[model samples]
Target: MQSTLSGRGFRPGDVHTLIVPLFHVTGLNTIMPTAFHQGATLVVTAQQSPRDILALIERHCATTFFAVPTTMILLAQTPGVEQHDVSSLRLIAYSGAPMPLRAIQRLRELFPGVRLHNFFGLTETTSVTTVLPDEQALVRPESVGLPPPGIELKIVDDHGDPLPANAIGELLVKGPSVVKSYHNRPEASAEVIVDGWLHTGDTASLDEEGYLFLQGRKKERVIVAGENVYPVEVENVLTRHPAVAEVAVIGRPHAILGEVVKALSCCDPTPTLTSGR
Candidate 1:
């Protein structure tokens, strides 16, 4: 994806303006090549402060930027970020974690005209899936998105049979971008990449329109009296209480139901629990 992005006309020819940290997978595989392949400048940074990144963008007139969700948030909130001449930034690729709706909206407000793409993948997969174009980033925030051109996706049940579309199941990915095996670990390779499928262990469902919606991890679900309970659902509900700042729900052992829901909550700064008392 980086190589393909680098070939665009907007990229500078200097080759030193493409900012990246060389030790990471994105730097080694995506950031560095995008610059080298395009003959664009690569900008190496010692630190990742929002101010520093914006300065590089202004100084180099960089046409593209790629970063994780956390960094993006920090940049948007930075004091002087808006003062920089960042109009040259045409493309911004973000991954590492799902961009929450709030963060996505904030980025749109910050960069009104820049293109944004969300990519999803593990290190072993070498970044196989990408959500392309700025539209999908806002319209379908949940989907990690369609597999990159060469990648294939399989949603299957516990028995390995392909489940119907829109059904929740384990996600399996296979493609040229993925690593065939772990370094010096045959057993680990066998456990993950079995028979051409890399079991993601994440629970997700597809919509009728084929957009994927990720639920929490498969292991996070609890079986209570044969009914499946997702802690996130309960937590989401409890968070609506004005006094609640944050909450976590877990499955607790129960003599009758085998398992029961237990909730732990952190109250707001000025909590008022007098009504319940």
Candidate 2:
């Protein structure tokens, strides 16, 4: 939490709004602790309504806001967003899922001066491991940025061999923040934490500059015939279509092919492609 606050330039006495559920790692571990550590006033919201969120920010002059990509998308799409006075916001951090490029662009358009950060972490890591800083938000929008403070990230193949840069492989993370074991789940913990490194189960690639680009979850891979298909890759391509509002890809059982890639897409104006499925 301290690492995240310091890395993102959050200062003491900042007003932070917490909209994410407290059960989640972002809320319980990251946002909450960070706010307390910085002596920031926290405004908690039970629901995720855009109106309420906007009202709280305007009412309390929130300086820092943390939410998932879905909530950010809703806020961007909500009507009358311009009426709210969100100029006080200094930092806006998003996590839980990979943010769409259009959503990032829309947030920039909506809040011109606010710093946007893309945070990446899991429950086992105790919250954030990497963050795409405000300056690099537009430069490398797809990357999750370099590891935060004490964290170390590496990409490794199935056999645990280190892969070269730009090779998509399982991401291994090691740091002080990583949990040593799961609560009463020793077997599960053993499977994930090997030596001092935690197997993140996420497929990603690292560039020469050490920026991480997530491909997708390794468990979400679809086996089509003998080929391995990553859902996020397909979703990224489908989202580029102008009509696509949201998309999720999965594997469907096929007798001959073993499995087939299937995509479920939501279109803005009820696209013609809806009939065939």
Candidate 3:
């Protein structure tokens, strides 16, 4: 946690505002410890309201803030957001889910001076394995950034063969932070951890610079006409539409194709379905 924050320019005497639930891994492992290690003030709230969060940032002069993409979207779109004083914030990091490019652009516009970070990791890894810094957030909006020091990451095919750059495969990670096994659940742990490497279950690809880009979860892939469709890829495209508030893509059974992509979206008014193909 300290390494994650320090690498991102967190300093002593900074203030961090956290709205994520303490029961979640992000709250327990990442935010709290990071703040404590940096000697920074930590302000936490049980509320998930965007308005309240904005207010907290101003009231506490929060220098660092972390939240999920959904929360960031809400905060960006919430009414009277501009009325709140968030000038104190210097860093804003998001994780736990895929963030739409629109939301990222919105944040950049709202907080031009603030640095944006995209963090990627799981509970087993003890917080973050990769961090997409503000410098690259806009240039490579889809990447989850490069891995930190002391961590080893790889993309491997089903047969455990290592894949080259840009080849989509299961993301495997090994490092000091990775937990060896789940307490008293050896069988369950075995399914994910093999040879000291934790199978993240996330299908991803690495660029030539070793920056990881998530495709989607292995279980979330839909095979349509023997072609795999990653839900996140479809969701990212659908979210580009102005009418879409949020979206989820899934596979529906199709007699001929085996499965077909189905998108469900939340919008202000009913959207007219149009087929380009």
Q: What value of lDDT does candidate 3 attain over all alpha carbons?
A: 0.87
Top candidate on lDDT is 2
What is the overall TM-score of model 1 with all chains considered together?
0.78
Descending-lDDT candidate ranking:
2, 3, 1
Error of 2 at 19 (Å): 0.4
Model 2: per-residue lDDT, tens digit, 1-277?
6687767777889998888888998888887887788788988888689898999999999998888899999988888889999889998999888788888888999999999999898888988889899999888877888888899999998899999999888999999999998889999999999998999999998999999999898988888989878888788888867678999999999999999999898887855555443
Scored by lDDT, model 2 comes in at: 0.88
Count clashing pairs, candidate 3: 0
lDDT of each: 0.70, 0.88, 0.87
State the lDDT of candidate 3 residue by residue for 10-124, as single tens digits: 7889898887788888888877787788688989887688888888899999998988888998877777777988999999989988887878998988888999999898889
Model 1 per-residue lDDT at 80: 63
